[model samples]
Target: MSLRGRVLGITLLLLVAALLSSNGLVIGQLRHDLVGQVDERIRGLATVAARLPSLPEVAVEDVPQVRATVEQQLIRDVHLAYLGPDGGVDRVVRAAAGRPPELPRLDAAAVAGRGGRPFRVPATGGGDGWRVVAVPRAGGDGSLVVAGSLGVVNRTVRQLTGRVLLIDSAVLALLGIAGWFAVRGGLRPLRRIEATAAAIAAGELSSRVPELAAPRTELGRLSAALNGMLDRIEAGDAARAASEERMRRFIADASHELRTPLFGIKGFTELYRMGGMPERADVDASMSRIEREAARLVELVEELLLLARLDEEGTAVPLHLTPMDLRTLAADALHDLRALDPQRPVTLTGPGGGPPGGAPVLGDEARLRQVTSNLVGNTVAHTPPGTRVRIGVGTEDGVAVLEVHDEGPGMT
Candidate 1:
């Protein structure tokens, strides 16, 4: 079921249970009090009839006189009966004469034994029922039994039940209506949040739930959390887009660089094949040129592969890490540079200049050496043949630092 339906159903169920419980209590109490009053009246009437002056003087054998006496003393809604010395009822007298109500046959012995306590008996006439009080006569030969009808009590309770049911139904309906509106009003913020989410899902990343009127409420907190999530998603998407653009540029640059070397090799090969290098010396020169371009192409391809691997697997590059001195690596790179370009004036300084002691770093030795060599080689490659180059290695900010400086024209 919808949330509103569930809320309304639960509310109505509780209300109905409470109303039923209270109504039952009220009706039960009312019935008890009314029946008690009827019982008291029945007992009182029995007492008065027993105490009548005419009842004590009457002879047991005189049935007509006994009936007449009981009829005279009877009050409204009360019935009086006489039991003979035997267990059977002898005569019955009512305040108003009609078809008399069906009453229990009383035993004279049982009536005398009871000591005037009232008891209940069902009427055979099938209506409300009766409250009976039996008392022994003064002479002890018989008993007087008094009964009162319960019709008034039953009628009053029925009327109360009808009224209570009607009021309860009306109240329940009003509460249901009020509760529905209250629940709907409470959930309005949630509905707004849902709409905002729908808009965001439709590619409107900037869409967000509006600031809540009640910021401290649960729905308000939920909206704030959702907006924070959207912000993160937007940031991640922008980063991804920028990364893709950078990759596209990098691929284009790599292709151009590779194409230049490949085109040189192709031209050299075509000149040799087209008989443009007929002399042995010309053929040797052509092969040498082709080898140089092939080497350049291979270097470019390796660099491209390294870049691709780094991008694909993040920083988890294969390395045989060992602690090695940065100074040793720098000295080695300077030596190699001097060998490759003998005319370039090279100098080693800092800790690597005088002794072996230098700042150490944990890394793959080959990769670290390659990196150092590349730095020094770049300096030599781009500078004038007579330029002076200095390779420095030391510790800075508790970290190993390597610096390559050359007295040459730098990149613009």
Candidate 2:
């Protein structure tokens, strides 16, 4: 079943159980109280009958006087019986017209042994049966038996049961209606979350569940959690898109760089084949140009491969880390720069005049050397030939700092 149905079903089930329990208790109590009232009335009537001042003192043979005395003293629906000292039934009287089903007879021993406490006996009178109490006469030797019918008590309990069932039906109907609405309202937030998810699946990643009015409720917590997940997913998607764009740009740049050398080599080979280089010296110069372009292409390819490996796994580029002086690496880089272009004035300044054991750092020596060369090469490639370059190396704040400064027209 749906959540709303399940919730309503369970709620009604519990309500029904409670109503049934209450009805049972009500019916049981009604029966008990009514029966007790009947018993009390019977005992009171028996007390009055026994204490009658006009009752005749009669022998066992005087049945008419005994019957007359019982009829005069007893009320309707109350039957009276007298027992002798030996527990034999001496006379019986009915307050009403009919014989009233035979009242219980007491044995001789019981009549003689009767006490002030009243006792119950089953009645043979048919309709709803009867409850009889026998009380001993206060000033006499025999016992006075009084009996009342259970019909009134049974009828009252039955009527009460009917009314309880009716009330329960109405209560259950009202509760079922109210419970359905309550459950629907409770699950509305989940429906909103589902709609938001569907919108996101349809490419609206910005869609989000609306904030709940009550943040401390269970549904509110679920909404918050779902929104958090969507936020993360949207952020990840944006990052992935940016990474893909960067990859596209990197590929385009690499392709352009590769094309330059390839075009040079192809042009040189075509000229050689076309017999444009007639002399041996011209052919040798063209071959030398081809070799130079080929070496540049190979270096570019190696750099691209290294970058790819690094992208795949950061640790793919192995490094042997050891203590090395940044000053020495800087001085070597300056030497190489001057060899490539002697007129470019470059200076190195730091601790110990930028010599060995100046400004030590933990790094791979070869990688540090490559880094210095790349920085100096970038300066030479981008700046004018006469640019004054300063390569500085020092330790500050417990860190080695290498800086390359140039006096050429600086980049915008």
Candidate 3:
């Protein structure tokens, strides 16, 4: 069952138990008092009959005198009867207003044995029950059994029980309804938080629990803590994405730069094999170019390992920053390109596109060299071999600019 249902059910159960127990006790006490009043009246009538002026003052001497005294004193509705010592019964009179149930016939000897105490007599003729008391006649050996009706007590208790049942049922229903709404309102915030969690699971990591009123309240504090945690989670996710992007770019640049030196070495070897380096001067020049490309390749490989370690350990190392000319980097690319493909015409120029000029910048020399190498390598990889190339270096808008242009089929 739902919590609301259970709470209301338990409350109603306790209420019903309390009502039943309390009402039962009250009804029982009322019945006892009413019955006591009946017994008192019976005893008083017996006492008056025993001390009657017409009878012997020592003990009841005649049954007729005892019966007359009982009838006279029992002013209201009551049962008056005489029981003889020999088990003979003599019903003298009954209540005039109603047909009261008859009193049981017991041995007069037994009535005298009980010392005239009152007792209950269950109904035998199916009318109302009776509270009875038997007293011995002072004038004769008989019992004066007086009985009073229990109809009033039964009727009052039944009426009260019926009313209590109706009132308790209505109260239970009203409380159930009110409690349902209260519990639903209390759980509304948790439902919203559940929705936010589902949204995040569906890939909306930016989703957050809605804030509530009163930061000091439990629900409100929970929302604040959840939102704070989500913020950190989102930031960490974004940082991871950016890191992946940087790693991709670094791998691509390293691959291209590595190709630049390898392509130069391949060109030198192929030229010597095809007899293009016929003279010793030509072979010596080709070997020198091969050695320089091999050195640049080694530097690029070591830099790749260093960057990989830095990414893993989250540390930094100082760079070899120096005042270097962009022209020097561009001229070096032009040299390697010419060595790779001698037939291709490669030109070096300044900002005005006239001739090579100085473009000074304070930066790491190895990083700047790799940047120029990647530009030249991309040009060779995409465009056809022996394509015309232009390498430039100059300052534009107070910013150093290096441009590598090729005259071949443009990139598709």
Worst 10 residues of 2 by lDDT: 53-62
Question: Residue 13 CA error for candidate 1 (Å)?
Answer: 3.0
Top candidate when judged by TM-score against the true structure: 3
Candidates in order have lDDT scores of 0.71, 0.69, 0.76
Question: What are the root-mean-square deviations of the candidates from the true structure over C-alphas?
Answer: 10.9, 10.8, 5.9
Error of 2 at 298 (Å): 3.2
Clashing pairs in 2: 86-108, 87-108
Over 198-259, each residue of candidate 1 has an lDDT whose tens digit, in order, gives: 99889999898888766698776877888899999999999898789768966975765565
Residue pairs in clash, model 3: 59-138, 60-138, 60-139, 60-140, 61-138, 61-139, 62-139
Task: Enumerate residue pairs that collide in model 1.
Answer: none
Which lDDT tens digits does candidate 2 get at residues 1-412?
8877888898899999998998898789878887777777777666766765334444313545444544453434656666665556666644423335445456545644554444544445444556666666666677676676666677778888888899899989998888889989987877888888899999999999899656798877877888899999999999899778757866965675566456556656766677778999988876776686577668667766776657645456677899887877776666546544556797887633454235788898755655665666668667988888887788766778787778778778
- 4: Cα error in model 3, Å: 5.1
Candidates sorted by lDDT, descending order? Answer: 3, 1, 2
Residue-level error in angstroms, candidate 2, position 386: 35
lDDT of 1: 0.71
